[model samples]
Target: MHDLLRDSPSSSPRGSPYGPGDWAELEEVARAGNFDVLRSVTYNRVWITGQSYCRNRASIDSCERHLQSLWYVYYQCARHVSHESFEQDRWVLDIIRTRGRGPLTRPAPGGGIDIARTPEGTVWNDLPFLATDMTEYWINSCAEMDSKQRINAASFLAKLASTRIANDRLCQIALDLFRDTFESERPLGSSNEADDENEDRHRTIHGLTIASLLPSACAWIREAGHNIILLSDASWNDCSHSTIGTGGFTFVQSELGQRAPGGFSPWRWLYWLKRLHQIAEEASKADEKLLAEQAANAIDIMLSDVKERNSQILRVFEGAGDAVTQDKDFMGLKRKW
Candidate 1:
C-alpha cells in the first residue's frame, strides 16, 4: 500500500535488489518458521551503512539509533506476528512503554524520559531508512502469521510507516549532518561517529545509494517542488569494511552504482549555502530568485557529493593497506546465534 500510494514500483525486476520473487520467498521463509531472515534482510544493510567506518573515519550512528528503534519494532512484530511459544503480550506492552514514554525528544522529569512521552510527528534521525526495509519484510512475513501476529502486524505497520513530511524532515537532518561534517564545522561529538570502535567485530557495509540511505530526504525535496537528483535511478552506494576475524567485501554493482543524474554534490551543497548567504545579502525581501537558486544548487550538491565520495573511496582503497570494499557476496552470510 505504501508503494502503491506513492506510485513507485512495488517490486524490482527478477535480478534486481528486492526482486519480484523476494516477496514470495520472504513469505515462504516466514511460513517455514525461519524468522532470522526477516531481521537479517531488514537490519544487515543498515548495520553496514550506518555503523561501519570508512574513508574519513566517519559512520552514520544516527542511522544506528534509527535501527535500534526498529529492533523494538521487530520485537513488536515477533510478539504479535510470529508463533513463538513465549508469551508476547507483555512484551508488546514493554515496546509501547519504551517508545511511548519519552526521549523521542527531551529528557524526562525524573532524569530520563520514558518512551511513551515520545512526541507525535517528531522526525527521528535516519527513521525513513530504518522503516523502508522493516515495513516491507514485516508485512510480507506476517502474511503467514497467526491472528496475534496479524494484529501486531497492523500495529507494527502503523508505527513504522510515515508521511512525506516525516520522510523529508529525516532526510534534511542527514543532509545537515553531512554538511556539518564536510565543513569540519561540527563540534566534536556532534555526531555519534566519535565512538572508538572497540573489540566488537567491525565490517564495512556498502552498495546503498543516497536514495537508499535516506529516502525521506528525496521525498522531502520532491514535495517542495524541487528535483532531488539522489532519487534518480542512476545513484549508487559506496563504503568499506575491515576486522580481524572476518574477510571483507565490496558493495559496488554496475546496476546499483550510477551517476546521480540530477543530484547535488557535497561540494555544491556547500557552494549553495554560500550562494544563499550571498542572496540573503542582496534579497529585497527574500525574492523567489533566491529560493529558486537555492533549490537548484541543493540538487546539484547532493548528486555531486555521491559521485565524489565514490571517487574518494576508490582513492582510499588504492592507497590503503590490504582491505576490502563492500563488494563481496554477503547474501551467503549465515548469522551465528
Candidate 2:
C-alpha cells in the first residue's frame, strides 16, 4: 500500500491516484478485518503526504486524496475499530501538533504560511472522525501557544463545540482552558499604542471564540444533573472552584469584574452573561429542574454583584458633591445602570 501510494502519479485524471483496483484490494483487506495493518499503512501514507504538502513538494489535491483514503478505511471498519486506537496513535498527535508549528518552509516567498489553509488544518476543521481527540489536544495546547495560534485553536474548538459530537470531556477541557487563561492576571498595557491595540484585539478574539463553547458546555452540565460536586471531585480536579462552582453558573459572573485585569471587555462580559441567561431560560422551558434552579441562583448572584458595583459608582458620584449628580454624564450613567 505504501509503495502504491508513494509511486502514484500526482497528475492522474482520477480523483485519487490509486485506481479502482488498488481500492478494491484495500477494501478486501478491510473486509478481512486487518485493521492494524490498514491503520499502519494509512497513517504512514497520510504522514508522507502531509509532509510533502507542508514542504511544498505535493499538491493540495494529492494531500486531500490521502485524507480521503483515511476516511474510506475509517468508515469501512468504524464499528470494529476503537476510537481509543485512533486517539492513541502517535501519528494523529503529530498531525495535531504540526498545526502549532505552522506550515514548513515553502519555496515561494510570502509571509508566514496560514496553517488554517493547510491540509492538516482541513483535517482539524472538517474531519469529525477525530474531532474529540483534536479538540482535547488543542484545548490542552492552547496555554503554550502564541496569541495567533491560540485564536486559531479557539476557532476550531468553537466549531466543534457547536456540533452534536462535543462530549463531556471536551466541555471539561474547554472550561479548564477558559479559566486558566482568563482568571490569570494579564500583562499591563504598554505605552506602545500599536502593541496595546494588537493585544486588545487578540484578547477580544480569544474571548469571543472561547465564549462560543459555553452553550454546549452548559448543556452537558445540565444533562449531568447540574452536579457541581461531581464535576469538581478529585478525578476532575483541573476544574477550578470558579468554574464548576455553582454548577458552572458562576463562570461568567466570576469574571464580570475582570475587564481591565483579565482582558475581557464589558461588552464581552455582557455577551457571556446573555448567553448564560439564554441557556437558563431554555432549561426552564424544557423543565430541566436542577439546571433551571442552578441557573436562577447564578442569575441572582450576578444581579447582586451588578447592584453592588452600581452602588459603588453612586457613592463616588455622591463624594464628588451635588455638581456630580447634576452632571448629564452622571445622569446617563445612572440611567444606563
Candidate 3:
C-alpha cells in the first residue's frame, strides 16, 4: 500500500503506478466486507487525486479508473456493510457537508471592513466530486442488482438525500445518469446473443431503479428550496424577478432549460409532470407500493399547487394590466412556481 501511494511510476504496462493486480487485491478485501479498507482507499485517493496531482491525461485516466474500481467493489460488498454504520460515519457526513470554502471574516484597520483574502481551505472542499462520483456509481449499480439489492441501494440514497447538504446538484447528478440510461440504445452489431441478453436485463433494472429514486430527488429539492426561502425571506415572486437570483429557483430554471430542447419554456412543467407519472408507474411495477402511492400523491399536490398559482397570476394580470404584469415578470414567476 505504501509503495502504491508513492509518487514514482511503476513498471506496469498500463502506465498506472498501481496495476491490475493491486486493484484486484483491494477488490478482494472490499468483498470481504472490510469497510476500513474502503475508507482508507477513499481518503488516500481523494487526498492525492483531488489536490491536482494528476498533471496529465494518463494520470487522470488512472485516477478515474481507480475510483471506478472502488465503486464496483462497493456494490459487491454493500449488503455485507451495515447501513447504520455507513450512514453514521462522520467521514461520509463530511463528504456531504463540506461544500465550498468555509466562511471567513476579518476586520480592517480603523474599524472598517476590508477585502478579506481567502484562506486555503481543507481537502474536504473537493468532497463534492466524490459525492457526485458516488451518486453515479450507485445509479449504475442499480442496473446490476436484484430487486432487494436495488432497494438497499435506494435506502442508501434516501439517507444521503435526507442530509442538509443534499441539494439540486446531487439531484442533478442522478437525473443526468437517468437521462443517459433512458436515451441509450443498443448498437447495431453482429451476433452476441448472451451480451445482448445481459444488456437488456441491465437496462430494465436501471430504468426501474432510477424511477424509484426520482421521488427522493424531488423531496431533496423541496427541502433545500424551503430552507433557502426561509434563510432569505424571499417570496416566490422575488425568486422569479430578483436580478441577484435565489438559489433554489435559479436551480429549477437552469435544470428546466437544460432538459428542454428549445431552451427554457413555460411548458417545462409538463415535462416534470410526465416524470412524476413515470415514477409512479415504475414503482408500481416494481411492487414498491408505498413509493408508488407517495409519487401519486405528489403528482396530485403539484397539480393543485400549479393550478392555484396560475389562477392567482391570472387575477393579478387582470387587475393590474399588461404594464404591471411585465414589470413584475409574472411570466417568469408562473413558469417557476
Candidate 4:
C-alpha cells in the first residue's frame, strides 16, 4: 500500500520534512489505492494520513500535527467505530465530524476558504489524502459492528500499539490511554446527557477485550497488507507493567524469523482466532494473575504463527538470489512479537 514509501514519501503535508513530491506521491497512491487504476483509500492508515496532510496544509502547527496523525495510523488502523461508549469515543467523533466528513477539497459554506475547504467547492487538496470514499468505507464498515464486535475491535487496536514500539511521546500517550480506558477495575463513568451514548465502564470493557487476541488480528491485518512489527512493549521501563498485561506474549524460535516461501496460508489464522476467543473470555474475568498466565500461553501460539508467517514471507524472495541488500531493514525484523 505504501509503494510510494518503498522509494520516498512525496507531498506529505506543508512544512513536512519530506519533500513535497514525495508526500504528494503517497497521497495520490493512497487515494488511488493503486497505481494502474482509480480507487478510494480504505483504512485508517491512508485516511488519517490524508487528514493530517490537509489540516496542516498551512504549515502552522505542521510538524507536531502531521507527526501525531502518522503515529495514530501507525498505531490504529480504523477511526472511531460506531460504539463511542468511552471518552475516547467522543474524542474520535470530534475528529471524524471535522476530518472524516468529506474529501480534502470539499468547500465550506459562504465561500469560506481554509486548508481543508476552498471557494472552488472543495477540490482535492494538493496531497489529496482525505477523500469521501475512504470516509464512507469507514462508516459503512463500522455501521455493521455491534457491541460484541466493537469489543473485539478494541482488542485489535491494543495489539496494534503493542506490536510496533514507536519511540515517540504520542505513542506513549496512546498506549497509556489504551491501558487506562480498558482496565476493568476502573468503574465506568456516569452517563452524561450531553454525550452521544452512555455506556458504563466503556474503557474497562474495551480494555478487557484488548487483553485477548493478538496473533489472529495481526495475521488478518498482515494479509490485508498491514504489517505489524514485533517490539517489546516493556523495552521502556518508564512504562507501567509488562505487555503481559495485554495477554499477548512473544515466544518462538527466532531462526525462522528470516524470509518465507510462496503462497502463505490464511487457514492458519483460524488457529490463532480460536485461541484469541479463549483468551478473550479469560481477560473478561479481570483477574490479573489469570490474564498474565494466559499471556504466557498466548506467547506459544503467537510464536508458532509468527514462525510460519515469516517463513512464508522469506520464501517469496527465494529465487531472487543475492540481489537484495544486506541492511537489517532489508532483512526485515529479526524478532517476532
TM-scores of all candidate predictions against the true structure: 0.23, 0.30, 0.44, 0.26
lDDT by residue (tens digit), candidate 3, 1-337: 4444333222222344556776666656655656665665655544444332223223243445544444444444442344446433444354454344332223444775332121222233332233455555555555554433444444444444445353323333333332432222222121222332232334543244444344434442343323222221212221112321212232245433343332112323333444556656776776767666766675665545545445332343345445534543234233443
By lDDT: ranked, best first? 3, 2, 4, 1
lDDT of each: 0.31, 0.41, 0.41, 0.32
After superposition, candidate 2 runs with Cα above 4 Å error: 1-16, 82-107, 114-337
User: TM-score-based ranking, best first?
Assistant: 3, 2, 4, 1
C-alpha RMSD of each candidate structure in angstroms: 22.7, 18.2, 11.9, 17.5
Candidate 2 weakest ten by summed lDDT: 188-197
Q: Predict model 1's lDDT versus the native.
A: 0.31
Ranked by TM-score, the better of candidates 2 and 4 is 2
Pairs of residues at least 3 apart in sequence or in different chains that clash in candidate 3: none
TM-score of the candidate numbered 3? 0.44
lDDT of 1 by residue, 1-337 (tens): 2221121122221211333453445455544555544544444433332222221223233234434434533544453353233333333433344334222333345775322111222223323333334434432333233334433443333332223223432222223322222222212221112222121123111211121112222223333212222322222121111111111111011221121111233223323233333332333243445333433454544334435444432233334333222323211111234
TM-score winner: 3
Q: Write the per-residue lDDT of candidate 4 for residues 1-337, one digit (tens) a residue.
A: 4433432233342333545564455444533424221112223333444555554343323433343333233212232222234533433333334433455432334676544433212322221222222222222332233333433344434433333322211123222322233222333222121221322333332332332323223323332222221212112222222341231111111112122211122212222233344444555555545444544454444445445556432332333345432322224213434
Question: Which of the predicted structures, 1 or 4, would earn the higher TM-score when compared with the native?
Answer: 4
